[model samples]
Target: MPLDTGQVDTGQVDIGQVDIGPLDTGPADLDLEEGNGVLNRDPLQSHASIGEALRAVRQDRGLTLDELAERTRVRRSYLEALEAMRLDALPSRPFTIGYIRAYALALGLDPEAAVERFKADEPVLDEPLRAPIGVPDERDPRVAAFIAGAVVIVVAIVLWNVAQRAMNASAPPPPKASEAQAWKLLAETRSGPVTLGPPLPAPVESTIPPLYETPGLAEAGPDGKGNDSAPANINDLSDAPLLDLTTLPATFTPKGKVYDSGNPQLGSLVTLQALNNAALIIRGTSGSVYFARQLAAGEAYKVPQLPGLTIDVSEPSDFQVFVAGQSKGVLPARQVLASKLAG
Candidate 1:
């Protein structure tokens, strides 16, 4: 080998045979994670039920019931029902779907997919929806008849009152004093300058008698010495105030059923009118933040319907809530209040 270094040997070197696998140019058959469509395990399919799927997703995200409730404005009870697959406990189909859609979106899942899964789990009713009782249909003949009767009765009462007024006007003329006497009285009264009574002097405190002191009976003994008979203070027996609970104003509760205006876009429109300056945070049921700011006095904010439609304010007493043109009453400052709207 040392001798061959000086000269170039014209010889072909033998290379050993080797096998090569085909190049992996195509997409790799990689397995994805549970939520990432991985390993042929659809997170949706792996679960025994839709509720299980939802619960898994929620748990995987480390969301608690209270946390989700605060986030979504959906009640904690309702969330529990959803996780438990208590279909009967949820609201109507439309409302339930709304809740599910919002929840799915919050969990970063496909809302449509969640909805479809939920629909499969819950059975739709074949029977038509039942209307609420006591609400009369406007097309009912009885309603029209009642209205007509009321109008007729009101008209009759008005006509009777009018006839009585006409009769009284035609028949009445009181006996008059002589025109000369009337003129004389008017002339005498009108000719004089008006005179006002002298102003009364304010009472002196020393001159005022004691509450129990009688005009004639003195507290002094027969010898004109002071008698210890009178109490230091005479407490009025009649003036003794008795607490009357009945005098308190009756509690106010909104009357009549609330009919949905059928505005799906706005479940419940609430407006806040600040009576004094306040800081507040408004959140949807899903706990989505809608507003957070210091609102000045007399400022008004109309908030869209959100989950739970909740508000947390620094000074609740400084503001009032209005819904559908009705006052909900003053808010308790520094407290969180949820919407009291009917389902």
Candidate 2:
């Protein structure tokens, strides 16, 4: 071989150094171990059930159900149900499908394919449609009876009201009040003087004395006349004056210009007469408008003597106030509170 080195082509070969270009620095191809080395089976091979396929992949990856549960964050019991294909033991279909997807991902298998296989194995049950039951048009006898009773009660109430009205209509009117009673009522309503009846005669003083003061009975008078201050007959009241009805002053001078009329029904008729053209507004204390108008000369408006009523006059002097037929001269003020005039 040493003698042939000189005869061989030196240009094509190197004696001590050879150029093989840069060595391949990329990662070398690695032959991954398919299954548990002993069986050398494909973990992702097609199986009759998704559960079997998942179980095989799990075993190939050397993972127990407890480990797979930890990896997938699924319950061990649920994983067991999935591996055993116990659809009843698993959760709802959607939840079971989620578990399957998680299990496939943990075992390095396709999640969608696993889900498809799970669906094919356990088809979802369709609920049978039910026909609606018909309701009868006939009403309950108890309800009808209740309605009839209600109607009867309403009719009875109406009839009772009619009968009460009829009874009231047939009843006689109340008796009229006597003159004395009328006077008493007027006195109660008005602050004015009321003449009840004519004045009675004065009482007569007896000139006789009591029988106990007789000279023979007990003590004697200076003239020896027995109690001349006492009446001769105790029962003789003929000399006594008649009992006077309750008396009142002959006249009532009101603090204000207005005075109450003796008649209660008519009240105090307050007449507002326009001496000249004037604008006036008659209202209540609560601001309810009773009258608002421009009066012509000599026009008159009878103001109701209702309490709390008031009058506003544009020209106080133009309007003349008359209460209970007595003239009060003119409007007391531009805005007159009628209650101030009430006696």
Candidate 3:
């Protein structure tokens, strides 16, 4: 301390402006002042750029990220990114530098030294961010598969919905059992002209009272209880089996021939066998006898042995008599009048 003799005391020296031993300016004291100045320097401190620092002095201490985190309370990820030099992964430039300062302090180094060193070499970046690293191009396989799967699922759902709507929209009201025959005909007509047998214009699923036999048969009730009774009207008599096509006079009219076999191998002449139940007896010109017996509705008939004189089966109403491959006329059951067999 600087002292004047007039103001000096022996035990405690006093001075008007005495030097307290040159203001306590030892190395330790000077270091303390310098450290305090660094701590309070500036609010907006500068930071280094990415990859600017080739090496870190604090890292030489051999402290691990976990070890340093224990000391500074910074997260392990931040400490790792800092040491890894993965600057882009960090929060911000100022924050990264600040973290580095704390890390240096935790490592028993001067915190300001780390900051100053980083500030000296600013990192330089030349490009803006676009695609991420390790990602594929526009036609990547994984991306395409994902998109395709999504599209397929969407289409399947749409098709299912369409099918459900169609089924619901086309639903018809239920009908009485008595009207089933008429309704069935109408329904079949929607598909196309239904042929019971080829050459027969209409398929006869319903019992067809023959054109001539219609005048000879009786009109039974809806249940057909009186089908055997005598003719109730002129039309009823036409249903009786009064004539075979062979017994008819040549003056009567007939139409149609087998235009095509539909199958060339079978040709136009198709023969069906009479089962235990048959319709009529067919005797060929070659002395072959075939029994055509109780004919069922929609049932077919064929001469088993007559390969060339086969019967082209159709609805009874569709039966046209083709003699020697020429059509005489269509056979309306019970009305057997032979006209020209050539159509």
Top TM-score prediction, candidate number: 1
Assess each prediction's global lDDT (C-alpha) against the native: 0.65, 0.68, 0.48
Q: What does candidate 2's lDDT look like per residue over 1-343, in tens digits?
A: 4555456554754243322323343222333343322222233334557788788777867889999899999999999988889977876678999999999888777788778767777787797854444656676789989999999999999999999999999999999989999999888889767779888888768878765643474455333465656533322223322322133112222322332223467555677777678888878778988788888766676676787787788876676666665665566556766655444
The alpha-carbon deviation from the true structure for residue 144 of candidate 1, after best TM-score superposition, in angstroms, is 20
Q: Candidate 1: lDDT over CA atoms?
A: 0.65
Give the range where candidate 2 is weakest over 10 consecutive residues by summed lDDT: 243-252
TM-score (C-alpha, index-matched) for candidate 1? 0.29
RMSD of 1: 42.8
lDDT of 1 by residue, 162-261 (tens): 9999999999699999999999999998897888999999978697766886654565654355665443211122222233435322332223222332
Alpha-carbon RMSD of each model: 42.8, 32.3, 24.5
Pairs of colliding residues, candidate 2: 207-228, 208-227, 208-228, 208-229, 208-230, 209-227, 209-228, 209-229, 209-230
For candidate 3, give the lDDT of residue 48.
34
Model 2: how far residue 291 lies from native, Å = 67
Candidate 3 wrongly placed segments (more than 4 Å): 1-65, 72-95, 105-113, 124-131, 138-276, 279-343
Worst 10 residues of 1 by lDDT: 232-241
Please list the residue runs of candidate 1 whose C-alpha ends up more than 4 Å from where it truly belongs after superposition: 1-40, 131-343
* Best of the candidates, lDDT: 2
